[model samples]
Target chain A: MTRIRIPPTLREEVGGAREVPAEGETVRELLDDLMAQFPSLRRQLVEDDEIAPFVNVYVEGEDVRTREGLDTEVRPGSTVILLPAMAGG
Target chain B: MVSYRDLLAQAKAEIDEVDAVRAKDLIESGDPVIVDVREQDEWDEGHIGGAVHVPRGHLESRIEAAAPDRTRPVLIYCAVGNRSAFAAKTLLELGYVEPVSLAGGFTDWKRNGFPVELSAGLDARKRARYSRHLLIPEVGEQGQLKLLDSKILLIGAGGLGSPASLYLAAAGVGRLGIVDADVVDESNLQRQIVHSTERLGEPKVDSARRTIEALNPDVEVVAYKERLTSENVDRILADGWDVIVDGADNFPTRYLVNDASVWHDIPVVHGSIYRFEGQVTVFKPGEGPCYRCLFPSPPPPELAPSCAEGGVLGVLPGIIGSLQASEALKLALGIGEPLIGRLMLFDALNAEFSDVSIRRDPECPVCGEHPTITEYIDYVEFCAGTREPA
Candidate 1:
């Protein structure tokens, strides 16, 4: 079971659960499984099959986008935390 | 003497409380008389527009005059929820039928981007002087008044402070306090534009004040002709400032400003410059990671050369200082998303701006959950320890 932790901004669109469990073998599969349950989150997280530029997904502490994007390996007990870029002063 | 927690707990048990959302709803729906019980300076920075002003100490004596009707819904708030809880209990005991405490208080209200109004005080002349600012929809009458009522403490009057203070003063920041111990040097002419050729030997604070006052007579500049040592950091910040602008060039003063500002719950607009690079961020205590959270400790002395040693581009401070001024104004207005958890890196040579996401370290020495540094530490000694390169 891979745990997908949602940030506060996207919580409302996904039933407000801070953490949701999904079964997948990779980062892409985990996101697909989680978004399948909550379709509303798909639009916010993904745009035309690519992760939104603002959203960053970290698998086991390393940013997956920097490593392998959606193809990053995942397994049971792996934690994926989503953080959005905050462009500010 | 009774503990503050005991009093707050007792008050909580005795009064009804409303969250910031519910409090806003109450204000929108009916004629609830909102009263802010924070200190006078905090109230001046920004308050829930139309909220009655009754400092917690005087609430019992002045509540009736501010909101006399016992039947009316009286909502009260302090810095956080604690003081307001006690104020609510006092209001309930004063025979008010529907007295409610704002659960998270003014800080929460401000963080939510709710409307805040300054008390009516800016004269027509001052308003006309700020006509250009008022023209912008984001910085209209309310924002201009907010600018006029805000107090920003610039930790240095050189380099970064030069442009930041100039713009802040021109923007009609109600009170601008400048802290700098050094005298303007001939070398400062290259970057510290706040001082002129004639004012070379004058104190930086004095020189900066003269420049700012000349720029805008409406601004009141308080000159602290002294260094920001650990001894005076708390004392200088004790009066409570809306925002703290870190313009210091040294590691010790920079860290001192961070710790003091964080302890006081005042957001710090931080900026730093090297030879051709600069960075800007807002170290909002409890809101995001502080300077300590970002650097943990100063870079080894040799690695972190002074501006004199590592010659900055003359215009670099102008760019980063302008950003600091912008951040301070945003904080004062309680509008726009500040760089609370983001560090903006600037490369002058390449003219590139990149942002790095910075999160608060839960184990951070100063701002962590179980923190070790409660008060200001010996930052000078801490930074002076020359260590071997790892």
Candidate 2:
């Protein structure tokens, strides 16, 4: 199971859980499992079967987009971070 | 007991001595560490071109710092070679391999027309004002002077700008340009420390200028009582700046600042806060990835909320803004590693700080090799998702 850390802005969609555990070998499988559990997250995190352009996923501190995108492998117990551009100053 | 002349003669005989002509040749040819053991006042008047000043009284304690490698040749000098002979003897006793005294000192060198470097040192007040900075090896006299000569333009005077402006002013940043169109409100007192209750209705730029000037008179504040739009960005940025501190409240201004900074070739210290989280980074154009590289497009308005709508922790901006000030100082001084390609995220709730690498995207429109968007566009409409960004 990989622990996916949720940003504060997206906490509402995950019942305010700071981190939620999901089971998958790749980022695609992890998000699939997560979206299946929390249904609302599908629209927020994915668009047209790809990670939303405005949303960035990091697998173990490395941006998944820089790696293999959704196909990037996720090791057991690895931490995943979902980040979006924040424009509040 | 021997007389002073007898002691002097013995000291001179014990150490190697070089004439002014020979000293000049050695300086021109070899990398000798020159030590000027004259008093502050005398050294400030004039000294050798590349000499480190260590007064006679501080010779034993400060010599190691001035010349760390004892194996290197040390050329010691005083007014007339008398003091340097004793200084050379001291260096020899301290295990220096080759310590040579000037046979005729600075006086003889000056007589022979050797170049002398006059010190443009800080005044007594400035020395005392920046004493802590002077004590740091990385931010010593030179770095402090650099700070005093630097000019930074801040995009806002609220929230993040409060702490950033205050710290930069206190640090003696010579000139500061603050741009804001809002007036201080009672609600802003919770976080905008640069504005006081008494100046509630006053313009934010004016309030900030007053506070910064009162804190440190060394800083000159240029107040712009207007918002930063695409129309005025060019004219405002025309007044040259060394670095920019972006603390804008909305996405429009943020994108405008980024685009202008890229075109101007200026480094920007960017900070933003929302609720319990804050992000800080240095977007240095031509050196690393720009804002466009990090966030190619602004998130939809639903996902992207302003600090006003979502609310931010009182001290969140303070923490983020202070980091921006630190990064700005590092950029101005050219010391240490600026956060050029790293995005630092601070979670106030968890009290955790994490960073991730941000690489320049080859397809970035602004900073990429083949750019499409050459001129500034309607940032407001663009950030609103109404108009597509090229």
Candidate 3:
């Protein structure tokens, strides 16, 4: 269980609340619970059992998708940030 | 007495010319002509669809005929608007009513995110209806919805189709289909400004399809490179197309398009531009004056002009074709009063567009009570044009 910080772009849907607490033993657990709640973020975040390309989800300013297969253990109050890479012409 | 757009020099001083956004605004205001003064190459890349291209490099030579009235107010634009400013000032000096310069050059226009057209061959009409649409409250959003939900079929990739096609694409029409069997030609570069030399030898449909795709993916383009003859006209018309805009230059195919639209219960947004004059009308057979109601019969085959004979003024279609696009958009949007019973006559020579209402003919064939065109039949004789096979 830890606190997850939503990005500014997506803060509106989460009740304008910058941070929220969730119960999850691992990254996978946390993401599953988040997706179950928001639903729309699943397509943008997950694909083929891994984080989708262009997406960067960080735990305490650290990239987690690269280090572990969503099994990164979380402390009781760790903050997560979801960000997607930007591209332009 | 003359426009600076066709200047012989590289752009002497900077003056704002009419870019597409301001041009569209003036067009929406219900008056003013959009005149482009870019070189042929620049125009081919992309110019305002309905803008008359006089080429800044050739201003003095064409202004007299392009804007015959020394007193007519015109908005001008060039690559950066400098040449056009020169042209506009010269026009003012010449006693033309008024010549307003676009705030920036076409490049500045693109940078500012304004609409410009890029259809090759004949650009179909792209003008939006100027009157009364904005006055209606019930139609605002609902009409835009209808336009987004509708699919219009455009015949030909030449002058008439170019403007029409570009406007429909920009106006956010849900789906648009371009049907043509020819490829791009250098001579067509003069008036058929949509296709670039880079796309030379490419099928007209493929060229138009790619242009639409690059410009806006939201508007799905279903291109048919095959000739739209009577044989397959029915099948193509049956695709639940909301409206059919006929730009076919020849008689047989034009009639074929008309008959198909009538049978399919789809409206026909009709447009045709000759040397200096053009005709525009909307047809749904039973609901309004059919194409037959206006022309009844095709002009003699020998007299019809292909790109070769009736050299279209590079910007002539830009005016009429865009109107066709506007009419099609209005029909789809259901926001404004459709040109259903109206005929628009435009004269670029005088830079004037006049409108007249047309009445349905009860004695007509297809849409008339006792009809002659029932089953899908051949129209080979009508499709005959003396020009090279297109």
Among all candidates shown, the one with the greatest TM-score: 2
Tell me the docking grade of candidate 2.
medium
- Please report, as a residue range, the 10-residue window in candidate 3 chain B with the lowest summed lDDT: B122-131
Which candidate tops DockQ? 2
Q: Chain A alone, model 2, TM-score?
A: 0.95
Clashes of each: 0, 0, 48
Off by over 4 Å in 2: B1-17, B26-35, B49-52, B56-76, B82-102, B381-390
**Cα lDDT of model 2 by residue, B98-151, tens digit:** 999999899999999989888776777998999999766577666898899999
List candidate 3 stretches off by more than 4 Å.
Answer: A1-89, B1-142, B303-307, B380-390
Per-residue alpha-carbon lDDT of model 1 for B153-194, expressed as tens digits? Answer: 998887888999999999999999998877888878888888
DockQ of 3: 0.00
Task: Give each model's whole-structure lDDT.
Answer: 0.78, 0.87, 0.66
lDDT of 3 by residue, B50-100 (tens): 676676666676677566766666778877656677787677666777687
Query: Over the stretch A13-44, how does candidate 2's per-residue lDDT look in tens digits?
Result: 89999999999999999999999999988877
- TM-scores of the candidates are 0.59, 0.89, 0.51
Ranking by lDDT: 2, 1, 3
Which model, 1 or 3, shows the larger DockQ? 1
